[model samples]
Target chain A: MKILVCISNVPDTTTKITFSLDGKAFNTAGVQFVINPYDEYALTRAIELKEAQGGSVTVLNVGEADTEPNIRKALAIGADDAIRVNLKPTDAFLVSQQIAHYAQEGGYDLILMGRESIDYNGFQVHGMVGELLGIPTIAPAIKLDVNGSTATLEREIEGGKEIIEASLPLVVSAQQPMAEPRIPNMRGIMTARTKPLKVVEPVGQDAKTSVQNYELPPAKSGVKMIDAENAGDLIKLLRNEAKVL
Target chain B: MSVLVVIECANGEVKKSSLEAASYGSKVAAALGTSATAVAIGDVQANALASLGEQGITKVLLDNDSRLHDFVAAAYVKVISKAAESENSSVIVLSNSNIGAAIGSRLAVKLGASLATNVVALPQINGSSFTVRRGVFSGKALSDVELSSDKKIIAVKKNAVDIETTAGGTATVENFSADLADADFATAPKETIRQSGDILLTEADLVVSGGRGLKGPENWHLIEDLAKTLGAATACSKPVADVGWRPHHEHVGQTGITVSPNLYIAVGISGAIQHLAGVNSSKVIVVINKDPEAPFFKAADYGIVGDATEIVPKLIEAAKALDK
Candidate 1:
């Protein structure tokens, strides 16, 4: 089985979001980028599946030159090779098309991706890619396993979960409890330095939507501090003034 | 051309998020000088489907497919796409739930339409171009997206829009069918497990969340009592849920269920950016923690720097007293 894992470079969760270019784009100044948290789960699970099933794992990303460093980081975490789609991923539709094109060409048995990228948070690609490739897509799976061509997964629903079984040549958007994400050791990091890193141009359709402007959430008004000694007063304020209850 | 809304129904009732979607679609239709038509999926009562007219939906298309009793994405896409084409829909609206996101993306590709998810507001029509503001960076900011394609599809975030009801409204329900092939049901879940007797965190109007500060799972009774008093759903931070202190479905954060309840009362929890991302859209936030410097206090509308273990009981008593 040849497994494909998709990753995205997103600002760390703690980064304070800011907009620049007169609110046309996100300001990247001084922001640190990491592999999206959800994608980490996919990457780690793909590696585990490869280790047990005797197959190869390849990492894929859609980004510009600056994202190369993180692509290399994904390789260091034990992917056999990497492919960077040389384009700024603007929308989920276009990105999924690119991924579908590559997956079709690779004839990969299993395709894996994060449920959504933290940057765009467009939880659209998994199903789009599945539809594009005419395959089944199980999203936000918390548990995934391979049992000789059939995969059983625990899919997360709103207030519960569902257990599902699907055959190979399927796509899955995985989340936590799939596997603990692996960090690069010195040996893995050194090996990744020489691994094949291929750069390919975007071979996908045009984006349907574009960002016209960006704005920060309204600055929070200062909070009202209530004394702990008078705990009941907080409930009183909630009922009478806040009126949320 | 009209607006097409997908109303997801399960166990004979429309999901709350779908209700929001219906309202959003109708409002958008009103804005565009058109009417809204709804397509209902899953086994639903006829009266329940027609009741959507209260949300401004004028017509309802009920698929009544037994195969779609559970969520079959492939079949669902075919059903919604058929409804859109039949209505000559220029705009499609859906709730940004899991099913909506899954189907909306596929429809966008299949129809070559501009798609936006996590939308918080209606589209602002500017001649030929329409722009929508959606929550980006997990509620940290909003981005105005321009849909350049002639066809537009929007997935509104749950609880972001208020529901509108038109009194004495009733819709005409029409039986609809796509006659989907068996391949569509191939990915249907083998088993579905639902949390019984617990308020759904995503649809709950009020949520009382706990964290590691609650000490251990055994002490969860404190949190439950507060939730019970306020008739609210219960949630936990990622770490607490990861450590098996709470069920995964009860976890709320960037990686978990992002909620926008009317009232979110967080107790014994430090404000992580991820956790805040889930609930920052809440109308009112109340935080109780022992640490005065807990970051949650900064974002909370009201806060008490005290031991949640001590304050929660008093707050519950105060809540119970309100009935008196």
Candidate 2:
């Protein structure tokens, strides 16, 4: 079995979001980048599956050169190789198209990705890729297990989870309960240098969606501390003052 | 061309989010100086279909297929595609839900329409170019995206549009069918195992959620009772699931299920950005934390600085009283 895991480099979860001077782009000043937290579950799960059945895991990302470090980090963790589609991912459609183009020829048995990229939270790429490639997609899957040519997954639904069975050549967007992410060990870090990091020029696809502008949300107001013992007063304030109750 | 809205129904009643989608579609149609039509699927009553007129839907195309009652992605895509084609819809609107996201993408490809999911606002249409603001970075940031395609498909985030009630309105419901083939149910669900909860998180108007601060799984009764009284569903933060205090299915975070109910009450939860990403779309957020400095209060509409043990019971009482 061969697996392809897609990852996105995003700002750390704790970073304060700020926009550029013209409010057209994310301000990168003094920002630290990390692998999208949701994608980590997908990467780790793919590596685990590969280890269990003797296969190769390839990591893919569509981003500029600055995202290479995170791509290498995925290699360090467990991916056998990496592919970088050299372009800025302007929208979910273009990103999904780029990924589908690569997976189209790669003959990957399983294509896995985060349920949604933390940066965009579009939650559309997996379905789009599945649609583009004409394959089945089980999204936001919490449990995934493969047996020979068949893969079983538990997809999260509203009140409960659904157990789905699909063939090998399928797409899965993973969330928690799949596997806990593993940090790179010393041996893994050293071996990462020898791993192949392939950079491919993007196949042309127009980004139907473009960023018009960006703005930071309004700063939160100061805390109005009601006495802890007087909890009822807080409820009253919610009904009368805030009028949200 | 008219705007097309997909209305989902189950057990003979329309889902709340689809009504919100209908209202949203009507506004978009109004913006474009046209009418909005609805395509109804599943076991929906004709009377209920006509009631969509309250949201300004002028006509409803009802497809009463038993196989469509449960979510069959391929059949839904085929039916919706036919509806869009027949109506010559330039824009299609749907709820940003599991069904919507699943079927919307395939329809986008079949119809060659630009697709946007988790959309939080109405489109800013400027001479054929449509732009929408969507929540990103797990509720930590926002992005304004322009859908450049001539045909656009939008999955509106739940609770983003207000549910409007306009009196003395009725829509003409007409029977329609796509003549789906047997192969359309290829990926149909073999079984559906609903959890033992009174209200589903997506359908619930109110939700009572807990986090690691609840200490252990044994204390979940308080949250459950409150939810039972209020007819809300129960949820937990990722940390609770990570620590085995709750099941993984109960986790709500960037990596978990994103829900948008009318009211969300968090008990003993310190708001993590990932967790906030899921529930930030709720209309009203009430945070109850012993710690005065919990980050959840920053986004909460109401905050009570008290122990969950003390506050939750009182809240349940207040809710019970309202029923009387």
RMSD of 2: 2.1
Native interface contacts retained, candidate 1: 0.81
The TM-score of candidate 1's chain A against the true chain A comes to: 0.98
Please state how well chain A of candidate 2 matches the true chain A, as a TM-score.
0.97
TM-score for the A-chain in each candidate structure: 0.98, 0.97
lDDT for position B128 in model 1? 91
TM-score of each model, paired residue for residue: 0.98, 0.94
Winning model by lDDT? 1
Give Cα-based local distance difference scores for all models: 0.90, 0.84
DockQ of 2: 0.57
Q: Residue by residue across B111-185, what tens digits does model 1's lDDT show?
A: 889899999998899789899999999888899999999999999998889899988889999999998989889
| Candidate 2 lDDT, B24-70, residue by residue in tens | 99999999999999999988889988989999999999989888877
Tell me the number of clashing residue pairs for each predicted model.
0, 0
